[model samples]
Target: MDKLLITRGVQRSPFWKFILWILPWAMLLAWGLYGAYLCLAEGLNQTNMDNRFAFGLWIYLDLTVIAFGAGAFFTGFLLYILKRHELKSVINSAVVLGLICYSGAIVVLMVDVGQPLRAWFTFWHPNVHSMLTEVTFCLTLYLTVLILEYAPIVMKNRQIRKVPSYLVFEFNLHKLMVVFAGVGAFLSFFHQGSLGGLYGVLRGRPFAFREDLGIWPSTFFLFVLSAMAAGPSFVLLTTWLVEKLSKKRLVKRETMSYLGKLSGVMLIIYILFKSVDTLIWINSTSPSSGFPAFEYYDRAAFGTWVLFAEVVLFGLLPALVLLRKKLRERMVWLIPSAVFVLAGVALNRFVLTIQTLALPTLVFDEFLSYMPSWQEVATFSMVIAYGVLLYSLSFRYLHLFPQERELTQPY
Candidate 1:
């Protein structure tokens, strides 16, 4: 059965080894499901979130994963629209990662909403004024586009491709992929911006509030830039990890270097914009709102160092490393640079979601702190287990890396 499903000419681990490898992740997924059930069945009370900290660990996870998932649309945009042929090597893997990240985020969101049954109310009773409404619509549409993009990959599986009708479907789907890529990019741009806009519009939380740039806030564009920068790095990191785990040269060194360079360039642009935004917020935005920017950092657990880490240690440092031909060419420096890029993005999201909520808004109010309950931690853990399991299955069955055979086999 395994042999029938596996792609021909590619060697996979023995069935027993595969099962052993997946066993722990499967158990973790089960535990996570149980935790999710507790959240949905009992109430959001099962988690540590409250009125002050309504958006907690779950929201942070959603933002981080969505940013990491940006690789799918950005890579597609490069390959199909700009005609960067080098990106074609990793495009399929990007699509799968996008699907997993997005679909998982949506699942976590449903549980977080605390009323899964009433989730349709957002679409049914629309709120044109809300950034969240825009996010909801774009996220759904983008997920659909990702599914369509991923379909061709699934249909290419060994036994699946053997069917005449499936082959025809895959062929037709390939032709329309560029269109989907365009739509996916459009949707991703808006939703990614809207997520940031959601926080930026918070007048009550002066720490998060940013001045409007035309109609949208500064964070809107900032989020889009940061996600674009982090996306390629995430893809590069995952590809390297897969290569190491499989002990196969899945893609050429040139492809990896290209990805690193792209990420580095975008990171530099993002850092520039972010630095400008920070200066503006500190000098003008926060001051105008009657809140000193330094005060926000003066609180417990969050300090000026967090900002420095996000901008300099993680942002500028990694961007420099990735941009350097000598550094990015070496695996030792390249992998850590990618990791730092991701960490910077995660820290940005953490500051937005956690630190924003922790700081007091009113003069009378003191600083507040909140932590995730076991249920929240488990539910989030579920997403990681799900991604690993799904990727493992896809790699075992599908031709995820197009260059694998050519790179490994004799000429």
Candidate 2:
């Protein structure tokens, strides 16, 4: 009975052991739900967010996961659209991770809005003029695409597939996957850019504002590039971690190398544009707006060194390492480099959201400082717990690793 649900030929932890491990994640999710309840029941006042800081940790986490979740569409683009058959082994895992990340972020957004029920207003009433309005539409639709992509994987379970109807459904879904992938990639590109555009179009806040290129800002293209760069590295790291956890080789090393190279190429392109954008903004945009580029650092926390670390330590370092065949091929080098890449993208989101709000627009208005209320921390932790639970369960029961059976069975 215990083994019935586990995929045939794949070994997993004892059922009770799995249950014990899941307990912690479940508890955390419950705690987070309570925090979300407080936010909804009491108000957004429950969070550290204020008029100046309209966004908080939840928005930051949303950006982080959404950026990382770019893995799903990008991988599908490589495998199905580009016909990179070598990626087949890792694409399922990418979809599962993407499903978790996208779904969890959507859930957080629901809670962050303070009235989960009113979320439909974006779709119903429709604010065609607002970037966030566009973002909401794209995210909601793309999330549906992710669900469609994920359904066939879930329906592949031993017991679920026993149903002839489910078997037929999943089979047909797989056939139409490329169409879905194309649509997903299309939606993802626009939404990811729009999310960045949300901040860039903030002409009222010079720190956050950017000069628009036609309709979109430089930040628009920068976001799309950065997301593509981070997505592949995240997929590589997740696949590697799954390998360590399962004690099995789930993907060919060449797949990892290929992903590293892909990521490296994208990162170099992103960093170059990012450098040019920063120079243009500091030289022209900031001064024209009467906010000197250097004046941003009047608040000690947003020091000059942050720009260097974001660009050089995290951005430049990872791109250089991943681009090198000799270095990225080694696990030791690949792991840290991938980690730095993730950190770099995450820091980019943080500065874009938090630092912009923290800076004082008026000389008399003090630079605002915020520490997240416990409710905010718990709410964010909830998403992390949800992701862990979903991924662990999917890995345990689904044939997410196509190479699992061959690798686990003796040659």
Candidate 3:
């Protein structure tokens, strides 16, 4: 029964093995759901987050996953809008990844908002001037665009394609893909920037604040560029992991190399701007906000070394590694570099979210160190389990990797 449902041209692990693997993940999902129920029933006191940290693990994870998910819209823009034919190989996988990232974020956000039922309030009673209002609008619209984009891919599954309507619907969807891709890219651009601006607008927290680049803060563009940099690298990393786990090649070396090159170039651009932005904040923005920037760093927690680690160790190193032909072509080297690129982005999100909140705003206030409760960790683990479960099922039943057939000729 399971074999019949699997994609026709590809081989999969035995049914029992697949079942065994998902059991733990299913348990994790249950745990996460229980944790969410607690948060909703017992209220915000269940978590460690207080007035100081209104946004906790849920928000941090949301920011990180969505940023990493940029590969979807960016890849779509390349394949459909910019006319980059090489990205066709990974477009399906990229879309699925984006769907997972965006949907999971929405779920976790429901927990973060305190009253899950009130989520509709953002839409019904809109605040036009708030940065969060802008984020809500773009995020919802872009997520819809992603669903429209990936729906046809699900219809492409062998069992689903048996229906004539599914086939015809999928075909028609392909024609308007350019429109969907354009909308998704435009929406993604604004929300990605607004997320950064969410903190930038916080004048009280000079550590998180940035100078306005015209109307938007410098952090706005930085967020967009950083997301684009991580997007392709995350795709490369996931493809590599799938190949390793399934023991079958899925994409060509040249295709992976192209992604690596693009990722590297974008990282370089982000780093250049980020470095300059950091210098400017240290020199001008912090001072203009009526604070001595170096005074914020007069403690052990957020030292000057943190900035160097963010820029040099993770940023410049991976950029160079991905750009080097000899380095990127080697699986041993390229895989770790891709991991570093993703880690760097994760670190950046952590700094912006946690560290920014941890710092004190007043002269007499003490710096803070946040530790998530068991509930928080469990909920976050649920996000990872959700990704594993969905990706497992999708890869088993659907044709996520279009080149899987050609690449695994021996299978």
lDDT of each: 0.94, 0.90, 0.90
**Residue 379 in model 1: shift from native, Å?**
0.6
**Residue 403 of model 3, lDDT score:** 88
lDDT-better candidate, 1 vs 2:
1
**Which candidate should be chosen as best, given lDDT against the real structure?**
1
Tens-place lDDT digits, model 3, residues 166-264: 999999998899999999999999999999899888888899998899999888999999999999998999998999999999999988988998899
Better structure of 1 and 2 per TM-score? 1
Please identify model 1 stretches exceeding 4 Å from their true place: none
Residue ranges of candidate 2 with Cα displaced over 4 Å: none
Deviating ranges (above 4 Å) for candidate 3? none
Model 2: what TM-score? 0.98
Q: Candidate 2: deviation at residue 104, Å?
A: 1.2
List pairs with backbone clashes in candidate 2. none
The clash count for each model shown is 0, 0, 0
Q: Tens digit of lDDT per residue, candidate 1, span 1-411?
A: 999899888888899999999999999999999999999999999999988889999999999999999999999999999999999889999999999999999999999987888888999998999999999999999999998988899999999998989989999999988899899999999999999999999998898999899999989999999999989999999999999998999999989999999999999999999999999999999999898789888865898999999999999999999999999999899999999999999999999999998898887887888989999999999999999999999999999999888888959
Best by TM-score: 1
